[model samples]
Target: MRGIAIRIHREFQLMDCASALSIEGLVLEMVGAATRRRAQGLSVRPSRWIREVKDFLDEHFKEQINLSTLAKCADRHPAYLSQVFRRCYGSTIGDYVRQLRLDYASKKITHSTESIADIATAAGFYDQSHFAHAFKIHTGVTPAEFRAATRKK
Candidate 1:
């Protein structure tokens, strides 16, 4: 018989009860997680960890964010978090953040005397160019152009 060895990292652990099962049964048992994950359609409602994930995104949109770190907080995988967050919120987290930034920029431009650069900074954009691009995409004009047009009309 051919033999192989597997090594597991101490930091990452999985629980398995397949030791007593026959080879075929062990294989079936190992496939159960995958089968159930697909059968149930990974769309869990946003409860528990998902709510915390949403709150974190709302608070931290101005900073660099990583899916791995956010998912770690929820005790879930990034792909899984992305999937269910989208399923529950009707949009991806990225989209939600972008919308937030644009909405905030719109409100700031409409109500505050802050320069576009300052508004962009406050909205979490790296620079005015990046902010302008996103703002134009969201509002159909460059920030200055938008301000001029709004003021004229």
Candidate 2:
């Protein structure tokens, strides 16, 4: 992981953030490498298929996700996909998606002036109330309160 970070820093110095494709490629490689290492270092070895499912979820978390759809994409049965995903990642797919949305919304809430409704929409929530409820459950604070706390740093 440290080596990947150093390589990424070197790549950035050579070009800049303007080369978003290069940066993204580097990041993907780093994540893949790290995942492989984690699987090897852990008690259980994760399937390569689970890694593919994880990458897909990471890329499409903002979109509506259906287990049957994901199963088709992964070429696995929906029940099997859910089983492997939980074993490999230690969370259900739905919970992972919810966490991803909340994390993204938290970043935007702290750094951007967007309204809570707009952030909720962008984070793939159907409505602000739902987003707020999920966010508060995950973080133990409402979005507005979290933002204010972050801004004080």
Q: For residue 66, what is the lDDT in candidate 2?
A: 94
Q: Clashes in model 2: which pairs? A: none
Candidate 2 C-alpha lDDT tens digits along 1-153: 443454455345445455477668779987886687577553376788888888888888889989999999889999999987876665688988887787678779978999999999999998999999988776556888877766766
Q: What digit string (tens of lDDT, one per residue) describes model 1 on residues 46-147?
A: 687788888888888877777898888889999999988876665677877877787678668767789999999999888999999988765445888766
Poorly placed runs, candidate 1 (over 4 Å):
1-45
The residue-level lDDT of candidate 1 at 91 comes to 64
lDDT of each: 0.67, 0.77
Model 2, residue 148: distance off in Å is: 1.3
lDDT of 2 at 27: 94
